[model samples]
Target chain A: MFFFKLPFLNLLRHYGRTSLSLVSIILGVLVIILGRGTITGLRESVIRGEIDGMTGHVSVLPADYPTSGLLHPLDGLYSLPPAAEQWLHANAVAWTRRLFFAPRLVSGIDAIRVRAIAFDPATDADVFPRRDWRVEGRIPETAGDGVLLSRGIARTLSVQPGDMVVLETRTVAGAMNALQMPVAGIVSTGNPAIDSIILFLPLSAGEDLLRTDGAISHVSLLLGRRTDADAAAQQLQELLGEAVQTTTWEKEAAPGLEAQDLRQRFLDILVVALLVMAAAGIANTVLMAAYERIREVGTLRAMGLTRRGVAGLFMAEGFVMGLIGSLIGAMLGAWLTFKYSIEGIDMTALVEEMGSGEMFQDIPFSSMLYFGFSGRTILLAIAVGMIVATISSLYPAMIAARKEPADAVRS
Target chain B: MKICEVESVCKIYGRGAAEVRALDDVSLVFEPGEFTVISGPSGSGKTTLLNMVGCLDTPTSGRVVLEGKDVSTLGERALAHVRAKRIGFIFQSFNLVPVLSALENVETALHLARFSGNRRKTAAEMLDAVGLRDQMRRRPTQLSGGQQQRIAVARALVKHPGLVIADEPTANLDSKTGTQILDVMRQMNESFGVTFLFSTHDPRVMERARRIVSLHDGRIAEDRTREKPSAAGEVALTSDASNESNA
Candidate 1:
């Protein structure tokens, strides 16, 4: 009881300094919780958006397709095994076939390379939701020269529906051919990889361009839970044999994962900077308190508190303050997480404020980014608070403990 | 039996050409239950001598025997332990912990000694003994100088220390309050048989001491003992002999 009493009473004596220290700690922890929580939520949400909207929960391609070349050949396509198709039908909630090709869209002096997906809209709609895809015009009709431009491509090419673009590529006959297509719509897939240089065309159009007879590049499967993606991929690979590679969305969305990792590193630095600044404030408070209470320290030493005991007293005070600050910060952080999770932080406004960049893609629901305060967020905040508070007080406590009794008591 | 003994103690400040001896072979012994005052002018080494005997400092060349154990060569931790367990100190500034109340201030010393009894009760009793029963909850800032000094006395005596050192304790208090504080210490000395050593320049304070040792140039010039002061310790103000002694 006295162990707590000594520090508690001492804290009451200098309430101002104690409060200042607590505020610094609380603010630091609050920032950490919010910052890390937002990032965690955002990264997870984007991954979810990618899986549900474009990449599906899993994708199956030729085993060597990943390393075959930057622009995987249209002719390298493998037909989906009947067993794999049966399993996907049994386990997957939705599925779609896509014909992928790397083609150049040419218009007068402008020509840009793009990864195009030829999809059957009726089935593709079931695999991917338009909620976040956000079409600016209309889906392509099955006939005529029709293509859907990604928002980025539409912006770069400055084209709207009814504008003509020339699609040029090497056909399976080893001859380069070109065809004119009228832009049908502009789409925002939310996944930066898909939006940067992606377009949607009728699978028949791609087949006509590539002369691949009727072969599709890969099949996308959506599952009830994303966590089941890896295990399902493994099951599909075994069922279909090793000739094809079945992969999760994380592998399929490599650039997004890398961007998330980079953002995570940035958040780590931000959290440390916040903690260091707070620690500096705590250290300063303890030092000033030590200087102010030199005589009291002498009295304590003369009274029987060992050098260790004197130091322990300060640490106890800091511990109490840190525990309070972290608890408050955790609650505030949790509230922020829940609040953002519901109402969401508007990414569209944030992107506009930040301006257009390669890092910030034009995903439709980029407008409302939600958040969650996971257990990891609160635990990290608490750890930073406790460690900073305790360590920051140690130097001043030791210095105070070293004060000479005679010098302090003299006058 | 002697409660404390300072044997031929010497203390010097600075080094080489800048050095000046603060104490030159000063020797003093405090008999058990004696109220001894070591009086001197400023810089006469009385405070230095008190510090050594209180075990707050160590002399350059001498032995300090506290409670029959020589603490002259003891390390800092050991000296601190002795200071905590056996010696109590009342400073000129009263030196009560400002954060602690009168009772807690007194309780602090007993706590340092690791006293086995009920700490709060013993502390309250000591405060009451010093006429602060009603003011036990007041902190030093809340109490007047006299009240704070009495609290300091309670802090010093509550641990039942063998030797209690007061260095010019009454210097900051007026004569009336000073006498009141002296009376409390004397009563504790009479009742509990606790030895006390004081370093002061006040003749009025010196007059109340049963033993008066005067110092000159860091050396003892005269040592005298009278019967313990009268019931009215304030009468020391009327004594001309104490005034002329320094002159």
Candidate 2:
């Protein structure tokens, strides 16, 4: 009790020095919180946008198809047997069939190379709903010479809904054929690559035009629960054997996965650099405070304080500094997040070079970017602050403890 | 009975040609309630002898017996325990912590001695006894040199230790203030039966002491007892008489 009062009063007496040290600590803590929060928010936003924009949780592709490597000539479409389809129906919650191929699209005087996707209207509607796609007209329901053109493609061809367009592609026998189909709708998917080059048609019409019978390029699935995606993919692979292949959304979207990995590595490097700088600032501030209080420490020792007691006193000071700094940093970080959450920071003018197309569209700094205060983040911040403070005080506290009573008196 | 007994205590500085013996073959006895002064020139080992008796420093050789316990054989922690409970010290510079009020400074000794219950009141009583009742709430820097020394004296006596070791207790004060401080010590000695041992070179301090031990060249030169002198000739008689008697 007697020992506790002395250090508290000492800190009060030297309020100027104490406040200076606290400010340095607060700046360090604020940097840590803001840096980590921004990086985490960015990663989460990118992942969520990617998942919702195109890829579902899991996808099923042909076993012979090398999805991750350079595209070689495809070895025809493979079909899932009745038993496999039954397993999918029983175990999977949502599934769709996609027939994708690169071909030449022609409308009037405009002719452009494009990628075409054929899917079942009923099943694909549950996953990538036609309502969410920006459309100039209604999507085609029956599969008879009907097609959907992307907004960019519609502009290039000077075509609108009810206009006729031609698609040219090689049939399974390697003969090129052209088929004229009516434009049922023009879609704007907001992604530049998808907006400019993608066309969608019904499965039966795509099969007839390509001269294939009941064969699909791949099947995409969305499990009832995301966590079950990986396990379902594995089970589908084992059940389908070597002739068939199964791929999950994470694997099929290799570019997105690689981007996420690169982002995490960059964030790790940045966090380490910030922590080192913070520790240095804290150490320097604490060292100065400790030296200034040499006489005070000596007096406490003379007043029957043990060496442990002396160390505890300085440790208390460090702890208080860290705690106050962390609290201030949390408040500052939360305020920044809240302020930006309501009024998003627009990057459209800044990123004008990336084009104004919907695909290369500006991502508003929305409330989605606002970080929620989880218990984990708070605990981690406190632990980091305290650990840094304690480590910085070790050298200074040791110096305080080793002082000689007589020499201190003389000084 | 002797409360403190130092026998053949020696404290040396360096090795061989650079050697300096701060206290060489110094032996002394301090009785229970006597006000004794150890006087000497600057490097004559008076402070060294006082440190050994106060259990603040251990001798290089020989023993310091306090109340029949040989302190030289004890470990560092045990020596600290002895210092806390059995001995009190008043430094020449009035080594009170600058952050603490005068009352808190005095209460420190009692706290270390584990004396509980009404500690502030007891500390106030001690400060009043030393004639600094009004200055109890002021810090050491706020008080005068004489007032700070009086607080030190109060700190030394508040724990009611068997012995109080004061090193140059009047070194930083004026003659009149020093005398007033000494009068408080004399009163505490008479009223509370607290033994006082001072290491000083001041003639006024020596005159007030009932027993005087003089040191020279790190060794005791003379030890004598003085029958209490009247106030008028006390300083002159103690100085002149000690010189003639020793010569």
Candidate 3:
């Protein structure tokens, strides 16, 4: 015997107001979905760049080393302790050692002080993206006297592969040392910092130039997943004891994450503001409807509709309005995401045009970026819309409920 | 037994220099099955009296007893409960919900009254009683004024309320339609034995009422009763003492 019917007719009575509310909610949901999708895309790209083409999941350093930055003094070098070496072999998917120094690269009159990094070229390819580096002559072998230079450095020297170059740096004993080796290949990492001043060579060539036997700078461990970096770092610290220090990719990428965090906070504030505007708009419309139908409300009350019953009707109306608007919004958001996902945003050109900034140093800064989004984003938008609408309806519904039936219909 | 008792109730309006007594200590009792009208000129308090009797307003002084409960003694919630179970209303403007069809308008009352039955079937029957079965699916806007008022009457009587209050129920309709709608109300009263309290400025409505209470200056100026209400209204009043002589 239920006779209280749909309140949709009331909404239909005011087409302009209803459409306005719907459009507001649609835009709000679109903003939320797009913001979330862009952030997710950025995060994924950064993690892939850092773990695969640059820093491994975790890096090990000497406990006595107080700070982390480029070019630690040559006197502060430490070897991989036997126990930590064993731990790396047992737990890590791949591991590599680096012997690095800031050296003045010289080829005739053209010279620049560049960060020289030596690697075990045999296992180095397992932890970094070098298999795709274009080769003019040949890649460096474990026993070869060949060296790799970035495109920027080669341009600075006006040299190419098969050309001879001299690397000059001071040793641990304050002795100046130099080595002349043929350039093996010129690689483009698509990252400005790595491309500008990086030099790669065989691990033996670096040890020979430094005049140290079995003395390496640090060990880097590549885990199967980026998310495992923190846990692996913690475990390595315990295994290596107090004499060694461990750091994760997150600590290294703090600056970039901090910028991302600010963007996220700004988006949160924007979402709240949008919801408030939507609430105000809907509240105004419902209030007007209540006022316009005062006499009808009075008639219903006299015929026995309770105050609670009246309030319930308005609440249902609000819920339905939000449900419809958000649903359409979700669909629109999905369509937009699909469009951009197929045709990625040109981020490499964008980053290049803007020059290099301090933000997102860990990210590879590739040529194209596709959004990462799921159905969850759409569902969250709908849920947020419904909650906002229901809350907005409260005050107006209460006013309608508390109206005096006797005076409402008079005159 | 008395269906409604207005015990010396007073309703005042305005203040000081503009103070006016809308109703001043007026008392009246209505029996079951009585088709009564509170008649007066504009500002004569006929509507105010109807409001007091219907429990839509609280009297400034004294009390209104509906069925067995004193409305003044009840809280807003409890009074609403009484209104839900015992009262129904019709308006001069034919205040039907424009969004709803004629059947739905009648069903709304049954729903609110918590009538535990097939609401649609009962509402359809109620509309049929007012000769609106064919227009049961029409919204108020789609129906003629007479048809809408007939739907209003059906809505008021659908729940079989103890008292049906109508304020100027016929003022908006033409002479013919107003009489026809009144005839529907009169028939419902005689057949169901339910009480009806209506206010009107129309003499045609008064002619059909079994009891006429005239208000002037917030007071009961005249109270008249007819032994048997006539369906022919003014025609019976004019032709009359012998309209019964033929019988």
Candidate 4:
């Protein structure tokens, strides 16, 4: 058939209009790709920071601990049996026990509210390595009257390493207890919330200050891979039964993570909406072109071209438009991503307002982003373009086909 | 054999009070190898009658028989099939697709006729026959009026259609160019045994036709045959022969 040459030459002949439409489609596609990609990147950074800094892939807590809503005073730590600890040691790649509570720290006239975590420095190293976490000084070598204060809290108290700090908290019997300890370190994590409020102490010192005897809050476990976390959680649930609650990192940090997931979903919806709008614009452009060529269509029809052939010509034009637009958009999007990925988008001012030290501080942008480019997206776009073009051509093609050859001759 | 037969054909437009009868009880027969012209002013229904015979339009009543089949009763697909296989059309404006070269436009018709293999070669052959082989690669816009008309002729004849319908084929050209186109049609009619039906108002085209049918007010005003030239190449008038017989 002479179909191949006609549509291609037609597009070339009307290069101005075709190029205009191609620009619109490319811009639309670029917006979708960049918008979705940036949002996903942000969410992933947050999730990785939270999971790696605090909770491991999975954590086990007391069975009586409330799973939903805010934690109450009655929600005490879980006490794992010897068998349970042994089971975790055998099954998990890395695991640690932690005692977590909110307490008061006092230095002279300064008093600050803080979250204190008691962890065995040796076992916890595999999960939350203290060496990289410490901004100054170091983790206490042994269980002694020593504490590590986040930089923000340390600044507020005008205290440093070797300075005496007082810690106070309520016992299970509802009585307040206090202990004087030497400041062991002042840490600065880039996260403002964590840097300003967290106070870490040796397990034995936390035991003494809180008046708790050898009791722990939770056992957090890290698997070799994130994929193993879910299955291990399920296995822990079955083995521990009703005596303990086992949760994956997703469940433990559901609130913060859910918000991130919602943002991702919104980006997806926006991308799809933009694509649909672009498709409509493409349909309109092709339809108008078809209308302008009514006489040409009539000529082809009178020459014995079938209705299908006439429609196919227009559809092929649209498919070519889609292919060209998508290629240009992908390249443009990748160039922009590369340009910005290196310098990064600064949100420091915005981050300060949100009570974080740096909102997106030098996001170690991955050298390559995974673009889910399969035959499916390209094929679908082509199919949609063709269908839209064919449908839009129907009225004009039919009008041409039904025209009297005599009328065409008269004109 | 009758190449086209229209029996009791009626074509009406609109409804009731506003209805216009384009063709009323129009019956005509076209014989093979004849150059027949249907000439009339605008709105005399000449074009409508031609469309019905060409299978481009259907009559509201009666039947149009083309090559032994009743075309008026055929569905759109079947009508298209018949048009593709048996009929070719030349339009006055030379409605060649502007995107394609002159050769490509002619080859398109051959493609539709299902002529397989070496379409371009066949198209060039048709163009060569029309004395347009040199201009085959030029687009329609690049060609002169007479050249475009020649390309249109090549397109119509590429499919070897048994019948050729030219609807005012010379309306857009000058008198000289129109005469050249008429000469081509006359030569094709004489050499190929293809039936020719022209709906035209050009006196030159009418004079060249072997049989002239004049239409007025939706009816035939006159149907006459001119006398054939003698072997010595002298023109003879049939009216003169009739008057001599009366004397």
Candidate 5:
């Protein structure tokens, strides 16, 4: 107890200097918590966008379809085999048929290029409900020319829920086709890229406009358990043979996810840089303290304190400072993350103002971002802080301990 | 039995052209309950001899025996143990650990000695004995020089060491404060039967000591015992006669 008390009291002798070291430690730990949380939140957001807005847990596409193109391929439309359809009905939690293609919109004297997605009105909601979107009007239903237009696309075409427009596109059989449709709704999906150039229509309308007779571009399945997607995809591929290709959402989103992982690695390096800077500050402070207290070291030595005891005293000072700063930093970081997770950080205006919406087309970044907090991260930050502080202080502590009692007294 | 013995101790510093002999073939012995003052001019080796005897240092070539054990060649760790358990120290600046209160300063000595008893009570009692019972909680900066030295004396006596080495303990005090500090140390030495060794240029301290050893260069110029100055402040050094007086 005296050992601890002595070092604590010694540190108080120069409270200003001690507080400087403490502030550095706190800053380093804060960066660690907040940086890691931001990266984790980003990864979660991308996964949610893929599973909910684009791909279901498992998807079956035509064998020749290319996933890397900017526009969806309409040349490989296929009718599902009876055996594959039977297996999906028995093994899947829910399933839906969808068609994707690029179309040019003609409104007034303007013609704009955009992507269109067609959904089966009845089963699409069960398999992949886009609960994240906020729509001004109702979704398109069966047997009509009504369509849902993204807010950006509607603004570009100067159309509203009751407005009429013409969509011109190429059929799977390589024939040019055009259709007149009435807008049913304007949807804001929060992702600027999707809102800027997307339109949703009924599958029946899509088939009539494109001249496909009961054929779809793909079938997306929602599994009973998301973790069972890989196995189910394999089973579907075997049942369907070579006519269709089965894949999981993870495989389809790998490129974007890989980019996110690279960013995470950079964040990790920044965390280490911050911690090292803080540790350097601690080392400097401890070394300065040792130099200023040479007389005190002599006095303690003459009082019968051993060299090891002297070293331990300095290390204790570092330990106490590190512990206090790390605890406060971690708690404050957790609190901030929790608050932001609930309230969310809105970057919609920023993204729109920057006009970088197209950059998010492939990665699918939503404007509202939330942070992640974990107890394990907090504990690890604290441990790293203490270990860094103690190790940094070792050289200064040894320097103080090695002083000769008589020489130090005379000095 | 001798409380401490320095046998032909020699301390050398540097080498060749820069060689300096701090203490050369100096021999001395102290007995229990002796109050001795070692006085000399500047750089006369008074501190070096005191350090050797106090276990604060070791001579380049010599033997230092304390309480029937040779400690001259002991390692730093072992020497620290000898100092902690059986010796005490006082310095010119009081060296009271400015962060600690007067009582806590005394408690540190007991802590180093590994005293397992009630440390606070023992430290407080020592302060009380030194006539600072009301100032136990005041830090060193809060106390006067004389009071700080009294705290130092209390600290040195708290462990009940067999010998207390004071290196110019009164150098930083005024005449009045220095005399008061010397009076407190003398009382402790007499009451506890502990040997007191000091290095100083203060005439008042030398007047109060029963033995005076004067050093010149690195050798002792004189070793004599005398009765403490009388109330009239008169002292006559009488060679071996003071030994008979002690008998």
Candidate 6:
């Protein structure tokens, strides 16, 4: 119908003005797409890093273990009973025991305080696969007395593999002790949190150094599939009894995810702000078009177009503009998401450049950040763009509709 | 039957100190097939009276009856219906929608009038009548002022309205182009028998009128009938009523 086609022609005739409105809508859609991508990507990356580097699919810790801060209390360390250990080995797909402690490493006169992870070298690799590890020397193996120093701590202490470093810490009995150990390898795992302030030691060495006999801080388990974690943890909890508490990776990662939620809230605010700005731009465009075409309104009315028809004309123009701009922006945003989700954004380089990788050690963080997006996100962007534009044009459309047919006589 | 009747119509603009009585108790009648010109100097109520008959505005007091119905009391919606189906307009500026081609401009009028018969064919034939058939696809901006005005004339006549109101339709054209426009309008009027009411100060337009209604100081000063333009280039006055009168 001519009524439907008229609005498009009207926009085409005034393309310069239409293009300005389109640009604003495009920017607003882009913000939405990128904002969602960033939030989803960050959340996924945190979960991935935690599952691979710290918690396996599930973890069994002492019932009263401290869940916050860098300094974990060593007194809570408990040795797995023979029955519990045998049941875990039989039931779990893969299992490993680990000890976490804070120690000060001294190389020559330089020293830095850091978190150290002691692992069962033989079974640790099965549960926690370390992919993309860059090391100068080889990692410590089963029963190996040598420690693997992270690249950042090694640099700070001015030490390399084959050098002896003294680790000073307190025993469970509250006695200060120091142990001299050989640095077997200096590694950069591409995880800023681990690389910057962590060191790896064999569990045997950790038991001997801390004089805790064979006790460990926790036992991490890997299930057949990620979805099996909750059931496996519940089963493990019944077997392990009340002395130990079984928790899934999701539960362990909750605190870090809260920070991500805060970021999501900020992104939500930003999305609103951007959309409002785009809507304002659309409103201004419609208003200016109405003002510029006053005589055209008069002529249209004189031609017997109802007031509603004139209003529909302007609203249709806005809707078309929003539809176009949002589609383009969504596609561009989606392309960027696909590219980064597969290739990943290199947070290692970013952290290294800023020299702030150590600050990330307190939370589950990864060096490669991947973005997230979906078809629903694109659809939502388009709908939002159209709705905002239509609403914004409402007032201007009314202003145009109010023109007097007698205005046709005016020059 | 009378095409339009204005019964003591009075139009006031603004309010209080700035109020203006643009048309003061002016009565006029237009017969079917009559090419009538309402001639006046500036501020002489020629346009105001045209507005009332065109259904573009309502009189402050009194009635404007178009095709047997009093339109002055009609609501906006009813007035729009009257304008669309019964009346056509041609402005001094030849106000064709610039975005549409000449053919499309004429087609729009048919569309507005809700013409049921072959709109495109009707529009094209109307353009052919105005001698702009070859340039029907060209936009208004692409055409000369005379051609644009011709297209406007085509648009006005294509809908077969009972009355066509043209306000200074030839004011924007040159003398030669103006005469061509006048010739096209006169030919259309004679062929279709669509009553035309014009408000203009152009002498060339006044010379071709079948009837001339002169306005002075917001009231009709003279209503006269004259013979169609003669081969001798002289207008022969058939009848003259030099006061508020009817044609």
Clashes of each: 0, 5, 0, 0, 0, 0
Clashing pairs in 2: A63-A245, A190-A358, A190-A359, A191-A359, A192-A359
Q: For residues B1-247, write the lDDT of model 4, one tens digit per residue.
A: 6898788788898999999998877677778887878887788889888888887779999889998889998876677677777888888888888878999889888878888768889899989988897899999999999999999998888788889999889999998888888888888877788999998888777777767676766666666566762223344434323212211
Could you give the interface RMSD of each candidate, to one decimal?
Answer: 1.7, 2.4, 1.6, 2.1, 0.9, 1.2
List, residue by residue over A1-411, the lDDT tens digit for candidate 4: 466677678778778877876776676667655665565556554555545656678887777665432232424655677777888889888888878777788999889777777887878778764433546887774667488888767887899899998888887567888888899888765444456567888877776666667778778888888778889989888877786777776665566556657977887787667666666666666677776777777666556556666677777667677667766776777666556555555443445466552332222112122233333444444444344434544554455455554354344
TM-score of chain A of 4: 0.77
Over A1-411, each residue of candidate 2 has an lDDT whose tens digit, in order, gives: 464676556666667766766666666566556655665655554444444444556666666665421142336586778887998799777777878776789877778877687888889866654433568886777677489887767887889999999998887667898888999999865444456557889988777777777778877777788667789888888887777666655554455446656866776676566656666665665567677777656544554555666677776666666677677766776566556545444443433345534433222111134343344565576677767776777776677767764445445
How far does residue A401 in candidate 3 sit from its true spot (Å)?
A: 2.8
Candidate 6 per-residue lDDT, tens place, B1-247, comes to 7888889899999999999999989888788999988988899988788889988899999999988999999998899888889888898888888888999999999998899999999999999999987998999999999999999899889999999989889999999999999989889888999999999888888888878888888888788787656423488776665334632
Considering the two chains of model 1, state its CAPRI-style docking category.
acceptable
Error of 3 at A340 (Å): 6.3
Q: Model 3, stretches more than 4 Å misplaced?
A: A1-5, A40-49, A63-72, A105-109, A125-214, A224-231, A238-243, A334-346, A357-380, B15-17, B234-247
Compose the digit string of candidate 1's lDDT tens values, residues A149-267: 98778888888888899998888777999889888888865545456677889878888888878667788888999888899889988887777787887765566557767988998
Q: Which residue ranges in model 2 land beyond 4 Å of their true spot? A: A1-24, A42-50, A66-82, A105-215, A250-293, A330-374, B102-147, B173-180, B201-204, B229-247
Off by over 4 Å in 1: A1-23, A62-74, A89-96, A100-215, A222-245, A314-327, A351-367, B231-247
Residues A1-411, model 3: lDDT tens digits: 232245787788888999998888888888888877776666655555555555678988767654433455667677777887888898889999887777888998889877777888778777776533555556677536578887668877888898999989887788999988889888766555565567788989888888757677667878887789999999988987777788877776665566667888888899889988988887887788888888887888787677887787787677777888788888888888777767767565566566532333324434345676778987999899887886788788898888888877662
Assess every candidate by TM-score.
0.80, 0.79, 0.86, 0.81, 0.92, 0.87
Candidate 6: clashing pairs of residues = none
Deviation of model 4 at A106, angstroms = 4.9
Clashing residue pairs for model 4: none
- Candidate 3 docking classification: medium
State the DockQ of every prediction. Answer: 0.45, 0.35, 0.58, 0.46, 0.69, 0.59
Specify the highest-DockQ model's number: 5
Q: DockQ-based ranking, best first?
A: 5, 6, 3, 4, 1, 2
Cα lDDT, all candidates = 0.78, 0.72, 0.78, 0.71, 0.84, 0.85
Candidate that would win on TM-score: 5
